[model samples]
Target chain A: MTLPIETPAVLVDLDIARRNVLAFQAYADRHGIRVRPHIKTHKLPQMAELQLDAGAIGITCQKVTEAEAMVDGGARIKDVLITYNLLGEQKLARLARLNERVTVSVVADNATVVDGLAAFFADAGKPLTVLVECNTGADRCGVGIPSEAARLARRIAEAPGLRFGGLMTYPPADGAARVQAFMSDAKRLIEAEGLEVPCITSGGTPGMMQAAEAPIASEHRPGTYIYNDRSLVARGVASWEDCALTVLATVVSVPSENRAIIDAGSKVLTSDLLGLTGYGHVLGRDDIRIDQLSEEHGRLVSDGQIGLQVGELVRIVPNHACVVTNMVDAVHVIEGGAPKGTWPVVARGRVL
Target chain B: MTLPIETPAVLVDLDIARRNVLAFQAYADRHGIRVRPHIKTHKLPQMAELQLDAGAIGITCQKVTEAEAMVDGGARIKDVLITYNLLGEQKLARLARLNERVTVSVVADNATVVDGLAAFFADAGKPLTVLVECNTGADRCGVGIPSEAARLARRIAEAPGLRFGGLMTYPPADGAARVQAFMSDAKRLIEAEGLEVPCITSGGTPGMMQAAEAPIASEHRPGTYIYNDRSLVARGVASWEDCALTVLATVVSVPSENRAIIDAGSKVLTSDLLGLTGYGHVLGRDDIRIDQLSEEHGRLVSDGQIGLQVGELVRIVPNHACVVTNMVDAVHVIEGGAPKGTWPVVARGRVL
Candidate 1:
């Protein structure tokens, strides 16, 4: 099926996306660390398969709905780990159901959450894995100290139908050393009590670049490597050519000589500014800035040097690719400027 | 279905939502104006039905997929108007098909777009209503002056299988008076040439509060009023109580005495910012500031007076309601602190 070169459509360069997957897997291989790419970035089973085929140990997801979507879309059992605190009856029920299908492990900082997971799994007659998430530095979700991490892990092991799955942490951006130290200390404290340490998962895209140097972590979970974006480019992790996703938009209205409006806007590109001024980077013109984006139009402010006419087509690399993927119904796959096919963002709004 | 008091789930106060619909419809009724509530706000057929039942002339959508979703979900025929420029073969084919089910009209600012629609309808053996969109000052999509507007309208009228509907303009935030003048001039110019003007549509929630005073427009398309947001409140168009939608989030991490983190971050709340200093307004706590938002965590800086512990629930009024609605899978209908039901944001990611 041929797609119109319209604004706001997520365009995936399959070649670049595959290369991104391979690069990360190779990095993990070189360091003897297991790779667990987070599926939250693409939210597609095919991408997950690519990672798994490239030697990923498993995948991590932020929401149960995302995990469910992935498993239902053909992800293997005993490979998906959810990195969110499980709360409430509805989510716990879903979590219990998910445990029946896979080796589902969840993170928790407080004993209350561990008890809740224990009650859920015990009632469901299933054994659930619990990871004591330590706040190495991010301070988002995790226990503060090694003693607290040990206490949470001990509570999980003591709770019925729960098994201690070792330590997990989403460290700060510059936290490779911190994660290494915390993991080493927490493991020693837990092992000193003669308990088993089955896993040590610590990863995020920003921290993953330095994670290979951290000897304590057995596995890494990097989500954004599958589709590098402008944020990654800014951080020197990836380049423009490495960005696998771009929004295909049409120049709808050229109101003035300097300003032209594209059909793609905040709804498709997303307002995930990611600290970058302007919405996204124009594909070919470094001089042109997507100055503003309304609901359905992206205003492009161009330097006078590059002359752009009305009704012309332009590709924009969004600041954040994962959020952009969530904002669209379907993404068009293209190879060398020719449309290949369109894939529906099946789990586009699975925000439970 | 019992839902936990999470901090970041989109909450639609059914009473206030219905009231906003009724109030907007009442204003249209008193002025002898047609009110077409934009479905891009809530993206639910049920909400659109409530507006129609309360005397809405029709509904306005931003994309072909949105219109398709609404019509498939039981929106009335001969009433839905798509206020976007239709381009490309795939979208034009959908537009031609949509004309069979509804009174579908599109706005175009350029002759190329007008010609594209005309060719598609001509090939389909149908006549489509085309509105010449005038850029009264939004600088988004539309012709700049009345002469360009008349030129586009004349081209549409002269083209085969296309009928010139009327003039449409999405005015700037403070350009209600400018829209009145521009539309009046365009209408007079077209009438002087013995042309028929069927409709004059002016839109924008900020300008819609004063739309009745603008005599040139026969209809108004205000999107955000169905769920007033912090931007509307900041603009003095609506009050805090008048806001029908909010994000119910959970305080998952109280890292420090002055810092708290919630589960709803940029991914759920969106990063529209819209020139606001913070992400959203924490209801009943003007002292707390949403300092930053990562993809899945909202960091709140408290002013020490308000003591908030972990696992506490809070309601956040989003900076922009429409963008936030597009981020979620479903919205909870809350009445007096209890969830009446959950409505799937069926058209949440319909950005074709």
Candidate 2:
């Protein structure tokens, strides 16, 4: 049988995506925390608009170019929070232009990044909002201690053409308690120095459901909920039904009785295992494990008869959704199991 | 203290790339083997032209759309080989269209893919070349044994509008003996069936230096030879000086004395570890290790003082060059440490 679309295509179930967006928005609403969804997951302007319409406070981006693409794609995005340390003239100048287009805020863990931001936006009519990124145990980026968080907050507040917005942390899995403890102490310390912490944001798809446990956080940013993947499912943060983005691939070769090769490989599904074993989870085929991947082929193997044929189509929930979305230029949109059309991943490859 | 290009940029050193291309071409020339360089590494038309100018027979692509991009990018590419088991009507239709531009050939391990190619090109003026993909050692794709390879070759030879070209295999590392053994058996079997084995191709960057060992192979396809990466260096196939592609990223945050975060992450460097330990090798900083990566940040850590200051530019040779080439939209070209212009990754995101 002919497939609905081409093989090895990223298929975003719009109905499921909308449901996921609204479900997370309602969860945050119930917790009395704002939802500032990260656009790195979908990267499509229409998906960002859907989140905004579903009661998101604004949108969160990782780079200036991502924010530029989102706003340039004609999304009604008026506010953007770039949750990365802005450095260099090229990035800062682009951030300044994006600031002119929308109310933009950024995060910084050191005085160097804060100084660059201040120097670039020194003469702007509106000061750029800056957040102190605190390390609540992720050990990725951010201040290691609450005292350092307060110190950076003080630096951002003292810098010209910058307003200290609050604190932000990309917390570890189940790290709501750590985020609360770290940000609470930092907030108390910054308040003692006569500065107000306007907003405290904590983000992670793994700890998204526990966002309310951190009562000090004014907002939470979760990027993977709209298109949950096998990683989230493995963490019990999302179920298979919640997965909206899947790679629809064709079996190009059944090399063995136990092995069938699909067209989606590292180029499409990506090599982001996210701590999972296999490349992806084939829907309705738990017996089949996507064992390996080359640039353009995914190897599916089973213990018994594989029961797959060449030209057979399979929808796979990749191990990580965000990276897969970034790998594709566009996604074929599906609603209620029927192909609707396609949505250009407007913010894809905007890594500048 | 300004970087020549933006942070998190893929920089291709033209001097090193040209040297690598010519070095490989010279190696293949001594072996009297044709060089069909895979375009997946640099994905640049100019790089393809350089390869062809270095006496390469043609270029190899993993996808039909990638072939389309390379040919459309104004490269003087007259011949192409897509080393993939392409199935379905859409891909075959596009492959048919690509055939109109250049002499295109494909590989298949099953009758399904062969029938699709035959049905697509049955009414075409020129017949399409089909090679039977044999699984010598790497069990990714292809027929498992020589008998299966000969059977598929006979099928392709008898198929209308298709010409049985030869045998092709993506061999395992250090599998030159295996390639010769399998291809020699398959050639004898196919010849007994009154079919001529015009070409027997084997490919792997790890085995590129040993291409001459497999005397039965007529040509070798190596993608990562042009832009050697950390994996190639680890395999002892290429040295650090031979690496052409490096990610020029800035240290955006110094979270601690032992830790620094770069702007390049999995989105820029990719998550294809290729069985290596760290994400990449940071040049000029042997003491530092890139221990972790998020979508937009790479965590560099050292046992002692990292010494990497914020805003410092560092060049990293990623674990895999081919996947890193697909992450960015364009790469900045550098010659002898000076910045040239940029080249769009013409075949990037063309998974279809």
Candidate 3:
């Protein structure tokens, strides 16, 4: 049966998505690195199950709410590592409660977070596993140097309710040497203090395949490999055919010879260029450029050679797959250009 | 009562918001022009009710779902003008049904939209009011010139299910003269065809005050005036104090002396620069700049003078408020720095 879908719906190619899962899992296995797929890309429980079924060690989440949703969605999750500092009394309580149900671990780069976390689980049956987030070269989160990461890890090992899990970092793209140097030094410093470094995690889809080059990283957590986006394509991580997700939109206006407006806008396609030019890539329309986006209108510019009439359905591979994942509540899962089922973006807007 | 809130939550200062509503209504009131606050900014029925209570003639929406949500939110909406092409079988039927309950009008820039709209409302009790969307200067949508507007208006007037309802345009910022000339010519053309030109509407918050200077405009639709953002402040249209909405985030990682990471990323604060320099204006900190943002991290760069510690809460006025509104599921309404209530962003992600 065909479903009458509205315009501007998120579409997922199930065959490609599953193939992506198997391919990445096989590559990691061949390279002798554990695969811990991040749930922030698709957020669907079924997708998480597919990754787990394909032999991912566990799942990685940036927020506690996402982990909770995956658990509620019946993923049979055995391990969850949130790569964000769990802050505030309210969030700490939620984290503790979530820990009660599963083997949950988190990362922290500061003493305050460690102290706040220690206050809650100081005498629990199973202490919370904590990792020192190292910056490496991403320059966004984590400690700047190996010494800082070692200092934070020592602080965590001394805390009563926490056990030092290991080290984690989302390194800059194509910076495998920096990841190796950062993790190896941090491990050396922590091991020098007679503390065991059980694991070292490095992640980023752009450099995920090169992660095995860094002997320090026992596991890698890459999110966007499941549904490669335009930015990934620009970075040579994935080709257009490897992109599993696309926004299905209908052309609503042909105002001029060179301009057409689609129903998809910043609300669905999003404005995250991620250093790429234009908003997205149109399949089979290399001549068209989605140059501008209004709140509800995507302004398409062409060279007047392509006659895209009004009401024509066009599929767009967005610049960033993660942002588009959070834009829609549910997506149409298709296999071989046929409808299969719809999956809810289970953890959308779980920023808290 | 003080409610414990989470970080990266969308907060609306009720006092500032109501004051903004009154300020814009007063401007349109003084100029003897109708006010129609666009509901796309806040997407809350309570906000629409406030705009209507503050003397707005009606509310403008970009989609039928927004209108339906406002009506369901108990805004007591009597009239809704959807400033988009109403397309598709399902959507047009819903638009016709919406017109049955209230005075529903829409804008069409081409014959396809007009023909589709006419097919749905050809035998209704009241014909759907159709406005010719003209391109004054913001050439995203609408007819190319006054002649094109006149042509579409004539087609709508001849159609049995549609009524020619004057002209509308999202005019170029600070181009009130362009609006006057374009709209006057279109009105003259429609008048020569022996049809009444009841209204000519111009929209945009950047130069909404100057919209009254356009002699042809009988109404103005402004959405962002209710919650001014950093872009408006940069445009010299509103002050930082005038911004009502802010993303409340906590410092998650203080990686280095000059860099800090916040919990609000593109998921909450968004990546819409709107030709502005930074992501947002950090409240009470002129020295810090939000240089970059990831999906779950906002990279704040400073000059080592500002000391932002971990777990420190910060309020940020985002670059664009409307896009941020579509990011969250709900917002906290605050009165005198205390939480009064929580209102869901009811029309968020309603791209259809």
Candidate 4:
């Protein structure tokens, strides 16, 4: 049978995505926290608009170009908080241009990033908003301690054309208490200096259910929440039905009784295992394991008869939704198993 | 200091790439084997043109869309081989379209794929070239045994508008003996049936240097040889200087004395470990390891002082080159340590 969609296509179920958006938004609402859905997962302006319409305060982006893509895609996104350190003149110039279109805020863990932003926005009529990113044990990018966070907050407040926004942390999984302690200490320190801490943002989909534990956070930026993936499902945060995006692939070759190959490989599904065993969860086939992947071929193996023929279609929930979304240019939007049109992943390839 | 290129930019050294192409071409020439460089690594029609100009027989693409991109980019590419099973109406129609522009050939390991190709090209004036993909031991794709290869060869020979081209295998590393055994047996069987084996192609970058071990192979299709990555360096196939591609990143944060974060992450470097320990090798900083990666941040950790300050630029040879090439939209071409123009990754996102 000819499938409705082509092989190696990213299928986003609009109904499921809308449900996911509302579920997370409702969760954040009960906790008295604002939802600023990160656009890194879907990268589609329509999806961001759907989140904004679902009562999200604004949006969160990881890079300056992401915010530009969101605004350029014509989404009604007015407030964008870039949760990354903006370094160098080229990116800051782009960020300055984007700020002209929307209210753009950024995060900085050090004074160098603060100074770079200050230099770029120094001559602007409206000063740029800057937040201090606290490490909080993530050890990825952020200030090591609360004192350093306060120091950067002070630097932002003292710098020209920059306003001290708040504190932000891409917290460790299940470490909401640590995030709370770090942000609270930083807030007290900043407040001791007579500067108001406007917003404390912390997020991770694995621990979003317990977001209230980090009571200091005024807002949560969750990217994969709108398109639940295998990682969240494996962490018991979401069920299989909650996954809004899946990779549709066709079985091209069955080399052995226990082995079959699909067209979606690392290039489509990506190699972001996120600690998962296989490349993805083959829907309706629990016994098969996506064992290995080349650039364009995913090896599916089973102990017995693989039970897949050539031209057969299978849907896969990738381990990480954000990386998979970045792999494709566009995705097929589906509603109740019927095909809708395609949505360009506008914010994709905006890593600059 | 301001860097010449932007942070999180992929830098391709044109000189090193040209040297790699010529070196590999020379190796294959000495073995009396044809070189059909796979464009899956760079995905640039310009790089393909360089390889073709440097004594390569043709270019090999993994998908129909990749071939279309190469031709669309106006790369003077004539002969093309798509090393994938063409299935479904959409892909077959695309393959037919791509065939109109160039000499496009494909591989099939099963009767279903062969039938699909036959159905698509049956109405065309010229027949499609079909190679029976053999399963030497990669276990990814291809027919399992010599008898199956011979059986598929006969099927292709009998099908209208289809000609049995030869046998093809994406072989395992250091398994050239098994590949030779498998192909020689299949070639003998097909020849016994009064069919001539035209071009037996086998390839893998790890085993490319040993291409002569598979005496039956008339051509070698090596993708990563053009831009050796950390994986090849780890396998002792290519040195660090031989690596033509590097991710140019800036140190965004130094959260701890022994840890630093770069602007490049999975969005730029990708998560293709290729069985390596870390995400990538930090150039000129062997003591540091790119231990972790988020979507837009790469964490560099060291046992001692990391010695990287915020705003510092560092080049990184990623674990896998092909996936890294697919991550970004364009790569800045560097020549003799100077900046040149950027080349769009033409075949990127053409996973279909």
Pairs clashing within candidate 2: none
lDDT by residue for model 3 over A162-269, one digit each (tens)? 999999998888778998988889999999999999989888889887887897899999899999999999988799999999998889998888889999999898
> Which pairs clash in model 3?
none
lDDT of each: 0.83, 0.90, 0.89, 0.90
Q: What does DockQ give for each predicted structure?
A: 0.51, 0.87, 0.85, 0.88
Top-DockQ candidate index: 4
lDDT of 4 by residue, B146-195 (tens): 99999999999999989999999999888799988999999999999999
Q: How many residue pairs clash in each candidate at the backbone level?
A: 11, 0, 0, 0
A240-284 in candidate 4: lDDT tens per residue?
A: 999999999999988888999999999888888888898999989
Ranking by DockQ: 4, 2, 3, 1
* Candidate 3: residue A343 lDDT (0-100): 84
Docking class of 3: high
| Every candidate's TM-score, chain A alone | 0.96, 0.98, 0.98, 0.98
Per-residue CA lDDT of candidate 3, range B232-251, in tens? 99999999899999988889
Q: Which residue segments of model 3 deviate by more than 4 Å?
A: A1-3, B1-3
User: Model 2 over residues B1-352: C-alpha lDDT tens digits?
Assistant: 2446788889889999999989988999998999999999988889999999999999999999999999998459989999998877778889888888799999999988898888888898889999999898888898999999989898898888999999899999889999999999999999998889999999988989899999999999988999999999998889899999999899988888899999999999998989999899998888988988999999999999999899899999999999998998889888867778888888898888
- Candidate 2's TM-score: 0.98
Cα lDDT over the full model 3: 0.89
